[model samples]
Target: MAKKNSATKLFVLDTNVLMHDPSSIFRFEEHDIYLPMVTLEELDNNKKGVSEVARNARQTSRNLEEIIGTNEESLEKGRSLGIKGNTHVTGKLFLQTTALPHDLPMLAGSKADNQILGIVSYLKNIHPDRQVILVSKDINIRIKARALGIAAEDYFNDKVLEDTEMLYTGITELPEDFWEKHSKDMESWQENGRMFYRLTGPMCPNFSVNEFIFYEFDKPFHAIVRKISGKTATLEIIKDFINGKHNIWGINARNREQNFALNLLMDPDIDFVTLLGQAGTGKTLLTLAAGLAQTLDKKIYNEIIMTRVTVPVGEDIGFLPGTEEEKMTPWMGALEDNLDVLNKTDEEAGEWGRAATQDLIRSR
Candidate 1:
């Protein structure tokens, strides 16, 4: 492979990066990658177990073997990453073939991290015009590299979102003048007692299906985008679950957000729903209400199966004796509390009726 230009970066891989994601080699796109000898040694040391980390290590070894092949000459010169149909990777892969001096002070020379850092330092010196950066998942390694005046960064390919604010909230608030701006050739009708509107405007193309849109102006409109074709979009008014008449299993939504969540949960067309909120936000309550309404009243589903991670807050109370359900009973305090609230929602139901309702819920 020919030498890359100064604009192309050379990334030094740490063992933890490969162990976290084996395909990271192909993820750098046009940037070249370098693997230190100590990184390969660490991969070999960790490839014995059946755990996920071990599996990744073994896979990385396989990928390297396939890239290297039987050619020894290309080992000294960098191998093209695009050799094995990896056309997306336009850069080269370099392996540490010769030993470099590791005389950096304030770092233990015997540590694998230090060895990788030494390779990075040497590469930076050799490639004066090119940018050589160390990509690592370990924070301490990155900090040490920066202290030694080396460029280092975390592997960002695995992160879905760098900022939490970028996450989609599944709901969007329309501008106050949304109706006026999008009313051009707007069509409205009722089908099966559900009101729907079809409108064309500049913003119609940006609407996505199943996304809830609400306007809290004069009419306080709330609807979900049902379809989008060309520059036209169709929205159907969502059911008002906050009304007592439209309550789900004797539970009415206390707020608009909870109503939207209940709408998603009760929609048979929607196969999956994810709710995000802080504690005491009624997430569990709304979910249980919708699930009970669908499973019991509507007969839409046979049962509801709820599971949560068994992680404890503090020191764990180990070794509970019983069957699977019994062992999990200690962690079901939240479920019990929520069920008590749901059972009390039926004001007409007497104490015996509430007990019988609880029995039915537990049976399912």
Candidate 2:
């Protein structure tokens, strides 16, 4: 594989890339941008709908107009993308005004994908001294670009994390001897049934409110940072959800992380909570159990409103004939499966009783 140069390179933007983020052109910083005429046509065609893609298309058109309007440079010679407000852009933007010297295997119809690929090939050929790459959000276009010997990349400007592993877990594991070193000016107190501790240390500044931190000693001590004042941080010790007395829906937390999660989930004071975990980590099970216990048993809230991204795991089931809840049933198999486990916790609630409980929970 050829190493990518740190020098300013030319990036050819696909219509989808611009629609994904209107500011993507400026996001390149010092790099130049090339927009194919076909890309502009596609953007114009898509700029007339009410959907999110349409709105993004319109925004991209407006941004392009602003950039072009601010620059007085000729179209053929290229124009500076930077305007008065955004003087950080040091690269120029060019539009494809002339025909390219290439031809692809003829297809049945006039496809936009082929036109974009041809433009990338043309840019790479003309700019032999510099690297010319195609940037798009479409997987198929990127694959086709690579097949045609053009360097292609995804539009990473709008991505939350460059790598999935870099996502914040909300839990920070402190060193085993963390408490020993940081406990010098520690202050402890019990407030309204909850325990709080204040410790001053260099690590205090890195802490954020509602962030879980734990120290591993003979036993794990887990707490959530409730407040931070300069070098001092007040951490509230997470409740022991594993204790038999505090079990929710007959489920005991299996680990420190689970216990901490249960603490957040069951807390009435915490208006909203987000749980993140990989598959088989009991994320859904814990959340469902806590929601049921609070809404059904404790009567803390009127009802539980559960919804999730309807991303299909396998082949989609196409259209289903049912009401809203029924249509959403296929997407909620995990939730239903967890409820079944919770319903079976009470052995006294035999087959018929379990069915009744399941039905009642489902009705909610």
- After superposition on all C-alphas, the RMSD of every candidate to the true structure, in Å, is 2.1, 4.8
lDDT per residue (tens digit) for residues 188-269 in model 1: 9999998999988878788889999999989899999999999899999999999989987788888999999988999999
TM-score per candidate: 0.93, 0.79
Q: Which candidate has the highest lDDT of all?
A: 1
Question: Candidate 1: which stretches are off by over 4 Å?
Answer: 71-73, 82-87, 160-162
Poorest lDDT segment (10 consecutive residues) of candidate 1: 74-83
> All models: lDDT?
0.90, 0.84
Model 1 steric clash pairs: none
Error of 1 at 250 (Å): 1.9
The CA-based lDDT of model 2 is what?
Answer: 0.84
- Candidate 2 lDDT for residue 295: 91
lDDT of 2 by residue, 1-364 (tens): 1222448798999999888888888888788888988999999999987998999999998888877785555677677778746688888788877777445774234588888787678767666778889999999889888887889999887776646578777889998778777899789999999899999998998998989998777887789999999989999988899898889988999988899889999989889888777799999999989998999899999888877998887888789998987898888888888988888886887999989988887676
